[model samples]
Target: MAGFRYEEVAGSIAGQVEAGVYGPGDRLPGVRKLARQFGVSVSTVVAAQHLLEDRGVIEARPRSGYYVRLRPQRPPQAPERTRPEGQPTQVTGQALVLRVVQAANEPDTVQLGAAVPHAEFLPTHGLQRAFSGVPRRYPGRATDYLFPPGPVELRQQIARRMADAGCRLSPEEIVVTNGAQEALVLSLRAVAEPGDVVAIESPTFYGLLQAIEGQGMRALEIPTDPDEGISPEALALALEQWPVAAAMLMPNFGNPLGHRASEGRKREVVALLEERGVPLIEDDVYGDLAFEAPRPWAAKAYEDRGGVLYCGSFSKTLSPGLRVGWAAPGRFRDRLEYLKYAASAATPAFPGFAAADFLARGGYDRYLRRVRGEYARAVARVRRAVARYFPEGTRQTDPEGGFVLWVELPAEVDSLALYQAALAEGISIAPGPMFSPTQRFRNFLRLNCAQPWNGNFERALRRIGELARERSG
Candidate 1:
């Protein structure tokens, strides 16, 4: 207990750093002074300073005392309110989406395109160890097909994690799928028929659009606020005007925009949909990656009736290669299970077993705390870089969570051209049009903030900004 006193001292210093008491590049009190202030020994103050230095909150000079590191600067402004057409638009960005997604996966390229977290931030070694033990632990289970609903252990772990998002779910209510993509597909299939119009957030994830188009459904893009998420007013108006079959949304840390709906807004949307008798499918893959304390609530949390189908995945938080995802489809549970059965019969057993093992071992929460802090710092660094390098007219989203930034460039700068130019330079960017069904947001682009901040990433960002300036000129 005496040896751990430094942690308390370090936390107090961190609090000061966060509270702006010790601003960027400002000198902190000397070790003796801090020791006297905290009533701790000089050795304890030294340990606390080391901890802060390791966490990147402060730095030490060769001959001088410690000084605060420069915090990530704020960007100019968030993008204005989105204005998408009210009517349904046929989805046609599948080919472009596929191309950009493939490019994002290329090796040796700076990846600022895909919304996936960098491998450096994930628990790759732990997951691999878990996977290694699965075969020996469950001899024949690895080879045999897991039943439709998937392994009970994995489902139970997922249900426990769901509570963090304000949803209390039973393991039996969850259906395991290959990934959140499949869960979303199953959810969409369970509720909407072919050719039905589904309302979605404008500038949403391209994968959602591809899935909607693949299902032979139309998309009605709703006006979304950068900070508050999809407008309840716009959604209510769309429902009143159109024959909307189902509504899909990412309420917490939405991809591209990274907008999170408030609890009241989420409840209002749910009540509106419930009154209209429309099923709601929620993609919450990024919910667990919130940078703030006390994770935001999912839209499913406010579901008084049973119209919310909540889909989540371990890909973002853990290894994407695991391909483990689950859906808690309320009221339509039977239909969703049937669809999951028809699609693949069962998810891969080993990944489920491994994930279950990982979660049960009690390491996930610790890992989340580490990664959440890293991602928050990384996002701030990326925002500061954008502000320094991007054209003067550029505006970007100040997302509360997740690792992606939506940048709105001048209208004269076409994002597609910027994408191509950036790709040639070994940089990948998700062009804005890919996120919209009607090819809107041509002047915007989404950048992945998951990668650690370094000189290489900074160069890539500057190059993209140069390309944008050239095009605009």
Candidate 2:
């Protein structure tokens, strides 16, 4: 579509400016030249140029085509790593998390609450063709009811992908699941008992908290760094003091905070847990979504002797509806496989077959290259908007990748109250309580930056900031 092609061109040009390819006031190539470069019509280039002008990414002169705009003021400082000081407690606040998440799924509301990728970012046509071709390509896998460990086609593809994360695995070692949530749940069950204590990052994904709650387990909130991720020293102290049975982490571009652990820190985490004989469930759902290439390695990459259980999903990078995820549950593979069978018998093979086909035949790498840039530009734009519109003393995370921004409002602004107020105004935001089991981060807000940059989105974000200031009053 011309609309999408123009957006792509606009995003690409914006990214070039972000990468310093075009400095402020530097004139961009003429529309015709850009059209030739991007292989689009002259009209599409004009539309894209108009879009850049509208978004303030560039300015135009009477005869001079366009030039990058001068950069804006720096955003607020990032919130420091959290210091969660509390004993392991049974997860609470599920009702609130559920309520906000459910509300975010509504179609009419301004959707700044959910971090789901927009459909424009998905390979819609390619996936449809892949799905239709699945039956023709793999007739048996498409029709047959696959048992646990799923179809070899999907697992093999997953294994191949995992190689980028610095893990060497085979199809037999991976168990396909409904999604990362299910894979995380299976990993939890495979290792710990119902009443055992499980350690987690300070402000982690709410879904994992719910999973821990469902299993009747307690979550030990560890002190995590905004820049470095879960602290190895803090985790060591927690293990020494508590009877932590297993630990879960997000090594690459974690949710809310969007912290990416350095490989050394990752190795330290893996080693610390191994030293304590505690299993590490590495949730790497956002690993592949790193804005730049040479994708970060999973903690499973630095495994000493297979104590790390790596869980990943295509839901974030690929289609979430596909519900394709896998777990490399080292040392607990058999148990996880059996439990997976007992819980769901087998995941639908058709999705996996389609995903495999898409990876093999479709331009997944090309898609990643494009979508990564889109998300990076989107996140940067949202950050700048927050800086321009939000009240002073409001700090937020400047993540290198991932499409979620964690904002720390002024102390007087309670995010829960803000969430309610914003909902009344037909806007949805994920309050800080949704990401924690202990209801910490009373003044924090996690804003989804996955939506396209548009006038409506800008208005909605500005409105949210206005509501926050009103609440602060």
Candidate 3:
């Protein structure tokens, strides 16, 4: 440690790169300067530079000094790929999801936040196998774009799969989009116009809020429950008091709250909406991820008139990177399809074909079964951890499926402050205010239970609890 040589200096520099102290393309100190810093010969510094370059960690330019390559600085194993450059689109609701992921993935962050699945549990190799088989079957079509409604095979599969949930649909009923996010957006554009009053769950997916905001529409929050999703009585009350053009909801595994509105209640609500002549946009992105018995069908299943626009995606089940999702607009299918064309002209081709092949290979059901089992176990662990570490009287909503857990902390605890403090401790969580219309759930926080039981996650949860107790006291 007293008089370090070349290997030590090189090791130290590599550690800095791994720690993100030097970013991609950042130049390293000159070899002579490094030699002096390490009190080593220039030859040793040169050898270290050569070693780093050989390892594909860095590269040297002809005239310039050595620079950190983008490849080497990245973790040898990242949880999942992330696109960091996308600007905060004026597009609604995107920021809410992004904010949660951003907080979780930050360096050294304790990720008690964000609904991301554990990296180790993901079926990456299965997806790769699915990808490989795509080109072998259709060498020419694999690279070609499937404009608008996406691949026919994938759409057909979706239509067929809808039967499991008690919904009857022809392939024409389905329109593929990038993800459920797009499905929600397309439904919003198709049914509601600018300045229309769009009723939403009081504490809804913030992304949906952003979508409504982007369309220049007004949002009316109906009081909702943590266990049963939107309160039917509350929605009926809002409909009576206000002239709502359209309503959006997550009837199954509602984000933030993880509530699954009962079938009886869903039917009642659907009937009421029909009587009021208002359309409903049902976001069911997590419907298939249910860990309990066969999940409930869409509220649209009961409607004869197709007043419900049902949107879902394989992003949670298969692969998020594929960005494959679909919509069944009970009455507005044509409008939703056309809107899909106008938005992106077309969904990417390979991903659609690959997804279709993946499902057709008889792997889809197997994957879901495995995912549900793993997630259920992880959820149990998460529940036990919360019950043990969180304060007494702190309530939690138990989701039948999906990876999100919403915790209600003491009223005195400001989740915004807790979020900020948790970030400093290298942990990330979604603040309660982001999910509400009037930010009414300021004392709440949403944690991602998708992460497995690990020391890093456990410590982060404890830290978050400590902070909450301090603030509450």
CA-lDDT, candidates in order: 0.87, 0.86, 0.77
Could you tell me the lDDT of residue 90 within candidate 2?
A: 80
Clashes of each: 0, 1, 7
For candidate 3, lDDT tens digit of each residue in 312-348? Answer: 9987777767789899998798888889988988888
What TM-score would candidate 1 get against the native? 0.87
Ranking, lDDT, top scorer first: 1, 2, 3
Q: Give the TM-score of candidate 3.
A: 0.78
Query: Over 4 Å off in model 1, which ranges?
Result: 1-74
> What is the RMSD of candidate 3?
17.3
lDDT of 2 by residue, 380-399 (tens): 78887888789888898877
Question: Mind giving the per-residue lDDT tens digits that candidate 1 earns over 209-230?
Answer: 8889989999999999988889
Candidate 3 lDDT at 164 equals: 77
lDDT, candidate 3, at 56: 74
Model number with the top lDDT: 1
Candidate with the greatest TM-score versus the true structure = 1
